[model samples]
Target: MKPLVMRIVFWSVLVAALAILAGVVYEQYGRYRAARDFPAPGKMVDIGGGRRIQLDCRGAGSPTVVFEDGLSIDGSLSWAAVQPAVAQRTRACSYSRAGLMWSDASNAPRSAKQVAQDLREALMRAGERGPFVLVGQSLGGLYATTFTRYFGSEVAGLVLVDPSHPDQVARVAAFMTETRSLRSRIAVSLAWTGLLRAAAPSLLPQAPNQTEHDAQAVRAFAPKSMVTQMAEGDATDAVLAEAGAFRDLGSRPLVVLTAMAPYTGSELRGMQITPEQGVQVQAIWEKMHEEMAAWSSRSAHRLLPKAGHDIQFDDPRAVVEAVLSVVEAVRAEGGTPPG
Candidate 1:
């Protein structure tokens, strides 16, 4: 009986190992195929050290507008709804940061300072000359703010959509302890190992009107993308610290879009928290947005009662109008339009 039990256990372990190996192989092949077939829709510009970043630009006008993504979002896809409309009036561009989407992964630290520097270099290489109007969503707000500090003269305006405040981590630490909880860690581990992708691909966010090409791209890079995003999240404090080094924007035209719906605990997936805690989170969030709006003397803090965190998806028109306002303001300030 003992010998038979040992054999059963050994065979079970072997089968499990083989299944995991197969999943890894399948995921790797899918990634390779996606990279070859769906390639970047825009140009790939070398940033240095043989690493390239993907950039997509549209329209023609001066004081070009550059869109930056929130945490984990592909820059190109996130701005799909707003970019076209903005492009109609002025040059609008978006690019994938290193390690996300088609951009080459970098060994550099995933902090805001490094990201800002890479973006500056990519812009110069891509010939998207600025004095740019920088539009940043969520965590991209941190990067945009850092960029202004590093290259103040090149930025003509700023627009933040549900921007992440530097003080956010500390502000909500009590309720957001789950960020470092065991369950969170396990989820990330599964993602890194491709188990999540194999078991439940739909758990990942899908782009609107997702095509077969887009699906392939997501399947191919989801694991790497999650890793990159996690790294960035881990480095949030460092990024916020770097952001503290910048001087306030004296009178730069700025627009801060704040989502009106308060958190109701429903947004936290797979995590349990009280409704009261959720209300507290929402209050802190709104306060942070308000504080960010105060960064510029000419800033406008617009509360979108109907929109959620993803204002671009929920209300593309609002984003377009906010950007248009900034562009018009910049032009009125006598900034030259791109030829």
Candidate 2:
């Protein structure tokens, strides 16, 4: 009886050891997969701070148009309709901000102002002579407006696609877990981290790579870049506060496109937005349109009935039309339309 008990204990220990070893192997494999599948971006430029931004430059003409992505995505190629359409009339560019898709990592804070400043430098260094029409989506809209405010006359026009209001910084802050509710915030953060870890094992590419080649393409694109910039302590609120003051943005011919429908996708399926809250946000945007119209007689709003936040993706035609309209409006205003 004593011998049998000892043998059973030994077997249990061996099985536990094997399980531990398997966990280690799985972790290593997950990391390997992430590194191998990073996105392949075109045209890289080192803009100081040991960081490089990936850019896509094409077309040629006056009133060059620059496209900016949303929170954590960078696929300029995705702007198939608008880029080509506008490029026919003027120089055009679409690029990934640092940490998205094919761009290099940067320790810089991801504020709208910082992004706008980086864009200016990129244009200068890249020899993209302005009279530029800056176009941005979502948070990119904040950057676009901020860019116009900072650059002033250098920018001829501005376009915003359902931009996040500076006021939204307050809303998001009130809800974000870190400042308001630590437990909830930590839980949310842990869930995101765990999801990535689990997906990393089977989601990434088999072979390791120098550039981002992981199945978690969004992760490879955003993790290192945005976290350092926008995800820092109440930074989003600070950026939005600065964005709230739009006195300087009034100088340019601005166009605002709004999405009227509710988000129904898997990502926002269970998001809790009270009916009153939805009405209030919509009202605020409507008021913003009125402010925009008052800001410039030429500033107008176009509603996209079936589109979501990423209007560029959901309704590229609408995006293209808005851009083209701006180009034409600027020309009509004698604002030096792109040649």
Instruction: Identify the leading candidate in terms of TM-score.
Output: 1
Q: Put down candidate 1 lDDT per residue, 288-313, tens digits, no spaces.
A: 88888888888899989888788887
Candidate achieving the largest lDDT: 1
Per-candidate TM equals: 0.89, 0.73
Relative to the unseen true structure, what is the Cα RMSD of model 2?
A: 6.4
Which parts of model 2 are misplaced by more than 4 Å? 1-39, 75-81, 169-234, 265-271, 275-280, 337-339
lDDT by candidate, in order shown? 0.80, 0.64
Error of 1 at 302 (Å): 0.2
